[model samples]
Target: MPTPIQRVSERIAFAARTAFDRLPPEMVVSAFGVQYGHLSTAEGGDLFVTRLGWPMLDRLLPSQWYADGWYASHGSQLKGSTGNVYRVASRPAGGKSLDLVVKFSRMAQEVPLEVSTGFPDNVPPEVIANARFNSPMEEFGLVMELRGGGAAPELPRMLTQKPLAIYVPPETYQLWELGRSRSRFENHGHMLSRDQEHATKAIELDIRRMYVLVYGWIKGLDAEDAAEDAGLDAADLERLTVEVIAEMHERGFRVLDNKPKHFIVRPLRRGGGLLHREGALVYGLVDYELLQRTTEHQEAFWSRRRQIYRDLFRRRDEPSPASSATHLRPGRVFGVDYLYAETPDGGRVWTVGRNPGLFDYFLASRWHRTPRTKLSPRNEVYATRTRDGIDIVYRKSNVGVRPRADPFERRGRQIREHGYNSPFETVAIAEALRRKGIAATVPLAITRTGHHSGTARFLHDARRFRVHEPFRTPGAPAEPILIPDFDYYTLWASFGCSGQEAGATVDLETARARELLDDAEFKALAGQSRADLVALGIAGVPIANHEFLLSTDAAGRLERDARGKTRVALAMDALTAFEYQVLKEDRYQDLLRRISGQLGTLGVQKLDFSGNDVLVLLGLDGEFLAGPDGEISGTLCSFELMRGFEGLIGEPPEGVPGI
Candidate 1:
């Protein structure tokens, strides 16, 4: 037990951290290793404060609410129907006393029959099914959010008691006594694992433990009590209640059991009339255990927030006050600097770069749920334009899975030699190739959902686990953290979707499917692509037709010479280009042979190759420009599977299929 002097000293220390009038950012602390991983540092332990409220640390300390503090309360107000709630006033030496409502948190308990049945008829089934009780932290968090994070002053603030703090005593109780399940506790642990890297603090509840929520009391009477004292009839009370409910819903919040008793109304003079703000009844909302955002509002909020995040990301390097508007922080994983944050759905995101502002632009909520066009049938890949109008293609990573192979197949032989590369490896290889004068699709970000992979769990792939050991946790000894309990998405900039290039690119597979080329022409184009890779020193993996995207004119037409032969060329950049005119069979074969002979001298191997792997540039008139080489050139788009000299293999003409 803390002595009186020690308690006072602790409160003073806590209050010292806050500026005199300005509120500090909401923060979380861990207790007994029941960590709020996303929001807290190792130094702060087991506490969560709402950012929407002014944190009166001295008034919020446990010493002001329990044991000696309880005995010192001036008096207790009438108890509410829910039980375990008490309103009291506590005074510190030489300081004005604070009126507070302290309640035992009912988190993890089943919703009572009356409370569950009290929801509006139109309430969503999903919301009703999950409407039990909010953990002390959740209740305060929702309150803060409703208060508009205290950062935005243009919006009208919600009228509610300021959430002070959640205090979890350093004590435990039996499960039966607490009516909480250990399974729920473990579930929180899983959520912690997914978002532990987030820097914002949130409260996480534990099983078999007591949580106390402290709130600043509003000086008013419930609508029912005030109306009666003011000689208003039941009809007036009902009207007031309905108005409050509607107001809350309009603000994107709703209470499951919205009753007149939950609305606190101040009396104007000796219970004669109720107070009003600008001709509207002023009411303070209370009881937020079942508070939630309406489905429509929730969707719109996320969309708007995602847009703001992307805007921040674009100017991340520039100085601005808006940088702190969204939830983002610096994170490092697998030797790559990423802007990291948690999605509203509890998933994790890591945008590959230094700009934290760019983190929200990659959130799955922004694109994954939007209408997307399937880019491939064999792989789980799709292209979608984000709410911000940026086109991106995202694919699930097969990092920890082995490839299916048969010894007789050419592609199988290559698959046996190298496995799929992780998203980190993909971006790293892309950057490396770009530095070596290869143009590739821009690798943007990666997202890991909270759900586990159903198939990968049954398979054995030790190599990926071993290679990614260091990424299990930053600064920790290599542990096998690359387990299969997650589905990772690798996001990339869509080829030919940047400024002035939108829809001006066509992959070879699409071209062939669309009959833009005859059988002989398609075959020659595929062969030319193979020869191009050979000259560039890409070996081992068989390049696929769909992986190569060629630039086209604004009208999506290929450049043709006077003889009606398609003029195919690779544009390296502003200063370089490679032109390859359609040639006769014998001439094309000679060029292919010459390029194939240079494989050993160049010595580069790609673990995987597809149309998505390379990009061709074009001049303003859609014609291929001539580079220094004046032959063929393109950018490497997919490189997660590319390898360096150490892992290079010689070109084998016999085993590679479709080449």
Candidate 2:
């Protein structure tokens, strides 16, 4: 990487001590744009310079790299922390140019609408979508444009605020430092007399001049944005801090190292009256190499920040005493943490948890019918928008419930991962059901084991019971039979819908239709649904197998008759033609037989190979029952049977056992 300085040898000499000393200053005097001048140095050190971008960036060419001023924060960036930030100007080119702090981690990036996961790097969108990081530094590069104005202070680490390190050229050791200032003068009674005169001097400056000039590590940045850069107001700044905490908790991150000095607040934007600085305010958490991936960061941050805030506020000389959670009120917020429940497919009933912010929301809500509840993003009308998508039980239901407990405290009581509480629990349940000669199966397990017996990520059912919510309405069903979501839980999601939302919708709708089949059309749909389910191999169900199917419809036609009266007609799609065929052809044999015969009758008939009716069947037999069988896998019963066993009365089987 060549420096912007002119003569190449001079550029190298500036970074050296010996051999290059003989070169003429003119040859060494490289003109690196306007701000950078070529010069020589002693030993070892870091170099900082700005330049225009390529065709030949060294020789400015037509490009989109026009930036007012951008800065680079020195040191390393951490996952979840607010800390000391270092800044210096970088060339105005397009590689992750953010005006605010950028986080680094394995955040799945999207190109247009395709889900692509990769490291943070500078490249065109199309190029970046397919990029990957080699190490931390490369993956964590952030270039933030400074906020407008100089009134607000930016967190050196966060706002590309640079540390003041005196660079003495090549091979020379650079010295960095820490500086302190007081607001005692301007904040009369606000600043503790750290030094009355010094504080007063700081206050004497124009209100705009009332700045705290601190000293520290890192170095240089001539970055600035003209119009949009303004500081945030004090109030808004505080809220931003809280929101930062919220994001950390929701993302399953824990801020390990935090100190007052580690925080850097920069004001690149204008002022926002008195509440907050004008432009967007950024709070960067620095020194995060010690971070852990637990959900405990909330407490750690609050405990540490409170003491720091308290000390800072008290130093202002205000006698008002206070604590944290000032923004949290009871009636305004509510939340729910899922406990444990069977999934849609009933595979692994995983036990997850609630993040800290949501925990706060749960504690703040008024008593609701559900045991627990919380305020979440409004778009959470479906799958949660958060990292864990932790659900808070707030809506009232048929289950009798009690008051919700505070999630912060409740998380302690939960099993990190519940054992038998998942869909896999069905293993035992299925065994028990099968022993009774009932046609039961573990279809989900089979679904997980692909047709070729491969592994699948959709191991758990749609509703994993990490946290199970009981029905809220007094007495309801004895068991909370969560609807199974075949699309997500089976070996399908990857090849199924686009995401959890679409997957959930399909499952819910199908489940509802299956549950509400007292009507004729629904009866047919339910029959097929059952058969389709069974053929998937969750045998031991009462529905008839696809092996035998019946079609039915309510009678009514536009036939011209003497009486000329007509009534509504009901129609049915044979359980076998669609349901049975789909399964026999697909891989769901357990599902095939289980859903047949369940269709409630209208005008019923049996179809032949050509799809013509060969016989009239009696209305459905009582719902099918699993017959006793040792080697068979699916239900062995009949729901709609040809009424006249009379037609084949002479053909008695030789193996008819005495029953």
Candidate 3:
């Protein structure tokens, strides 16, 4: 009765399943990312299994889901409000036998009335209202955490089912068939976002897809059944339940629908004695869909973690006993590449460039917490030499801030037009300009500060929330996933530093203020730089005097012209060793006129272009290093708002042709 295509498909599926079985399982899981393999089943299903689950993975194949010897769980507690659960026992020929507890995932479904109404009367109203079942992935992740996935002395290890795998069958069903609530599904994004700690956006549940969770079965009976078999008094069983719940609470976990039925207990071989440890009954906890941390515990945990981060920041140069290098991985955002990792305190760092060595240098604890000189009084920007002796400038990002209520201010107006660029955008723009032969500061990294921002309530800016809405960790907690509630920090290589010496680099504004260059000289250089950038098709550049950094030689002495004028050096000719600098005085009038004319011909405007954004370089003996067409050397040092305009200008030749 099968069509030819169906028959061929079945054969192909069988071959794929056979090949999957032949592949060696990867046993060791690294601390960084998920290490797993996708498995295709003969019954047209998919399985994602961890290294720990790899041993018994074959038993999880969809074809054997309902095979002989698997029976529905009929305990009193399993009879109501939970997903379809079954106990499966398999003894394969010449292989290790497996006992699995297979349950269909009930993600996105409302808590059954019976379950919701069972919450203790003392429980918070909000907790009861928001209770729902966990997705398969979430349940597994939580179970791993409970089982000491990242064990610490303070956290007590709790016995629980070993999460083997998550499987999805080939068949699909309508939402109604799965008893999914449309209202809950539609409104789930924010809640899911709140629950997850992912890098981006809120998680969404696929109502049409059925997800199943498979766990290694614990050979035990529920508390009630076990107590009946053990002939324990009611008071003893009640005391056991209370003690177990308290221990789990101390370990930062809670089950909203807590009941004795959820706990599994096993008896000893000899006299049918119950398992005990340290004068207390030992039991395994199960059914974790409603698992969560208590509020007081979560707060204390984060507070302690914040202190640890501060300590780490102070001693960054010293070898860390808990090096997080293993967790670092290659990541790219926009056009820039980064070696990124989540910090021990729950913060994240995205170190720019491809080198893994640069990752630790930009960690917030390495620089932000160090003693530093304020670089900008108006902003929380500072210049600090890291414990490793690398100079860097770090500034708090204002992506989600509104500076003033006075709508007339430049910052306010700018915020209205375009939300301040996120740290990722800032670094991406800087990197792009560098690739295009434009001189700009080196962006070191971006940090998501682990501390709660708490600044969103005072400001009216919704930009950060909207911008980061797409990057959310699924099934984290609602508090940690509120991206807008956390502050962001961006790091940049100090532009003024040359090697270990500081103050070797000075911006045009400081130079002018220090009388290194007179008023007319400064204005002329700034104007020419703006004209050159506009000619190159970049507009809206912030080129004010402070934005232009001028470099000094190793001894921190400025290069000078024959006439005793401080010279700003640009670049050196490889063949001639002659350096180029912007023309001095009215000598640049002709070149400036030409560049301005080119800007006009290209029909572009200097929106935010100013003298502060320019840089100049002088040749040997302060002589001019002119191009073939007598072009002057002018470069950009700032690109916060720089944008590439359309048309007119051709790409610069290989060497930029002396521009």
Best by TM-score: 1
Q: Against the unseen true structure, what C-alpha lDDT does each candidate score?
A: 0.58, 0.25, 0.57
Candidates sorted on TM-score, descending: 1, 3, 2
Against the hidden true structure, what lDDT does model 1 obtain?
Answer: 0.58
Q: Where is the poorest 10-residue window by lDDT in model 3?
A: 572-581
Index of the highest-lDDT prediction: 1
Q: Sorted by lDDT, highest first, which candidate order results?
A: 1, 3, 2
Candidates 1 and 2, the one with greater TM-score: 1
Off by more than 4 A, model 1? 1-55, 69-73, 77-79, 115-121, 124-130, 149-155, 181-204, 310-355, 360-442, 446-637, 642-659
- Give the per-residue lDDT of model 3 (tens digit) for 465-576: 5644543332233222226767888887655332212345555554554456678988876776566545544357454444444655555456665875554432322211
Q: Which model is ahead, 2 or 3, in terms of TM-score?
A: 3
TM-score between candidate 3 and the true structure: 0.48
User: What is the C-alpha lDDT profile of model 2 across 1-659, one tens digit per residue?
Assistant: 54544444455534333233343433222110112222322123222222111011221111111112122322233223323232222234434321222222211112122323331111245433443211111111111111111111233223323311112222211121111122322332222121122111111112212111111222211112111233334454445445544444443342332232334544333352222245543344443323333323333233233233223322321222344223221210002112122212222121112111222212211111122222223211111111111121221111111113233653322321211122222222233333444432211111110112222443332233222323221122233322232211211011011121121111212222223122454445456555544554434645322112222122211222376321111111223323434223342333342322321121211111111111111112212212353211243111111122112122212432211
In angstroms, the error of model 1 at 606 is: 6.7
| C-alpha TM-score for every candidate | 0.56, 0.20, 0.48
| Cα lDDT over the full model 3 | 0.57
